[model samples]
Target: MTDEEPTRSAPPEAHAVSPRFAEYTDRLLFGEVWQRPGLSMRDKSMLTCSVLIALNRSQYLSFHARRALDNGLSPRELSEIVTQLAVYCGWPMASAAVSELAPVYAERGIGAEDVAPEPVPPLDADPGMELRRKAVLDASIGAVSPDLARYSNELLFGDLWLHPELAPRDRSLVTLAAIWAMGLQPLLDYQYRRAFDNGVTRDEISDALVHCAFYVGWPRAMAAAMVAREVLVGDDGEDHA
Candidate 1:
């Protein structure tokens, strides 16, 4: 962000990035490629967040986490993405990402010292959907791997889902997109139902999946749509009954 820092230059070789790697990744990749066309820097940063979290790139996740905030994403939103990604990308990565962010929060003055006492609770929002969401997650992932199932519940649901910054709708969208991009079809199917349980509309979920298709691929989008149809059917059945 400083003038002295080269905005479009390759990452330093001393940082273990080879000159060749720098050409493709740092210089051309970020500088020329990501900068080329229609997308704004803010949108690019959000995309970067999705990719980094999907790849479990802890170091880049930290780097881009700060950039995401600089581009207008909040700490709470970043936390939510990391938490949601844990369902697909795994928790060790999320933990590493949270570790990467602690200092950034300190520097940004996010704690009590920055804000006066408000009468409202820190997390005053409705949390009722959480229990229902757990049932969906339990059913979706419970039979798979215990480690994955446990992390999805304990860390993502218990910790990040409770963050107050981003709305549940936004959080669910990010979760759905991340899982979709990661090609975790089963989890995506489960999260499709859970997203509705958290009050996300079928239209919003459909739109998000559609928007992500170009980046994530038609196959993944089709799979997500199939799952979403099931959710809609289930809702209709409940309504008719």
Candidate 2:
């Protein structure tokens, strides 16, 4: 099949179990939500795979892994995503995602030789940029864990974020999806702001939250909305997008 075709196929029994739900899945979720204009299918697929990975939903994760490949995400990009999430989500969850995607990669003939190494920026890449990134991390979570603050600077923003395989905007989207799906509001709030800083527009963030509502659940989405609202409106009540 061509890369454009969806890798997932609904089973006939799905329609038999609940016609209405099945219709919604096929017609609305896949047809409408997946076809939305604001986000490309590649972005949507990235979000889907990340959400499923965060939730530890192996079945759906496998499906979306194939779909991500079909939607134009290279195996190397997917590998980098897993590696990046290892820090944000957890090593176990990230490892599980990699295990689940192994067969999918094998199917596509993407072996270890084909997977690109994660890029490492030079130590002197930009001292000013590194300082700014450290300052942001310190401001956000430094009080809680100085080690975490250091890790965030050295690993997350320093290394993973600098990887050219996925654009910063797309990386922000995936990060947002993973945290939102896992219902981590404080981290979600932090990520939402970081997302905006990384070029994820307010409307795109809102759309992402809404899209996640279907997969992650309404309660979490609502909580995320409240956080977004608070972020958009500063302490002085000014809308800051």
Candidate 3:
């Protein structure tokens, strides 16, 4: 907010565009919503960057990537985040993020070692989780594209999700942000529950979708929220008859 700190703020020229918007951004968005309890600044930064990366908003993403690193996302963790996003958000968006963030990483003196990561041990095995995942994929896509199912099971979830650079909770958060940004309704349905299974709290999930709105837009965020509600509360036992 000062000359000494590269704070998150509206551009100085933003006033010329719309003083009202700039004021709301500074006062309402940053001052209030970002400070909301339960979500740490670091996690919020991670979520924000994930949404931007999913939407391919490279301009804002590069700016926020700087803050994300300062907010405790390591170069390796950020790299892994982009890698995970590749599947859900597509290779092009993730590739573009890598291109844009390269210089930002350089400015921070991030060496090759900083982004090089090793896979960790497998998740403590859970038969239920495995079965549920396979069943859902089989029911949804296996009928049409068995290859996609096999790869999603063997490569995407089996290999990629176990990368140690990013924790499971962070993976769920990043994935949710990306899927929500793209308005992938089916993925949102499952990811909301995946997030909960990974220990992301309900409040955190709500906050994440809310954070995603700024970058991905309201319609997408709203659709994500509706799916989250269905997953969390389950039609509220309302009448279907």
Candidate 4:
């Protein structure tokens, strides 16, 4: 499928239960939020899949897995996203996402070999990586745990973030979605800002959280919206000052 095509199909039965919800889902979520020009379909797909994976919403993952492919996310990129989430979310959640996508991959002729991640280059190859890592750690938690800081730098930022299959912007979107789904406010607050730093605009972040409400539930999305608003407002204040 081409990138311009709609990744997700319409519900088989419209107004099957609640017409209001179906209309909202069809008109607002899909029509407006997803169609918002700030974020690409690929970006939205990655964000949606990451949230679904983090929440262990396996039933919905299959549809998104197929959608992700249509949206131009490679199988390898999707696999790497699951791998990254294993560390950030949990092993079981990531594992379930993989299991949920297996059939979709098979149907598309994406074998295990096709989805295997490429070898990550050494950290030194990206000279600025350490500097960026230290800046983030210093700003957020002050790197209180030596081991954790090392892991975050050498593994999370060094490897996963640097993975060539996905751009840093895409990685930031995925990370934000996972943290939001889990309701980790501190991380959500940090990641929301990080998302902006990684090139996700404030409006895109807002739209993404609204899109997530349907899949991850309203409570988590509402909580995340507050964090996003705070981060954006703080940014605006800084710009004005």
The candidate scoring highest on TM-score is 3
Q: lDDT by residue for model 4 over 1-241, one digit each (tens)?
A: 1234243335756567676666666666776677777667887898889988988888899988898899988999898899889999989998898799989998999987897666776323345746875777866655477677777766787677767776777788888888888889877766766667678777777778777777778998888887776766665566410
Error in Å for residue 228 of model 4: 3.0
Ranking of models by TM-score: 3, 2, 4, 1
lDDT to native, each model: 0.64, 0.79, 0.81, 0.77
Q: Could you arrange the candidates by lDDT from highest to lowest? A: 3, 2, 4, 1
**Lowest summed lDDT over 10 consecutive residues: which window, candidate 3?**
1-10
Q: What TM-score would each prediction reach against the true structure? A: 0.54, 0.84, 0.89, 0.78
Name model 3 segments beyond 4 Å from true.
Answer: 1-8, 236-241
Write model 1 residue lDDT over 1-241, tens digit each, in one string: 1223235355566346465565555444455555544544554566567755665666766677778888877665666666666655777767877777778777887764333232444453346766776676678778777677778677767766666566665676677777777777766656776667678776666555644564576897788777677666665566311
Clashes of each: 0, 0, 0, 0
Could you tell me which 10 consecutive residues in candidate 1 have the lowest summed lDDT? 1-10
Predicted structure 3: lDDT: 0.81
Tens-place lDDT per residue, model 3, 29-140, is 7766677777788898999999888888877888889888888888898899899988878899989998999889888899898888764566664678888889989898
Regarding TM-score, does 1 or 2 come out ahead?
Answer: 2
Clashing pairs in 1: none
Worst 10 residues of 2 by lDDT: 1-10
Query: How does residue 7 of candidate 1 score in lDDT?
Result: 51
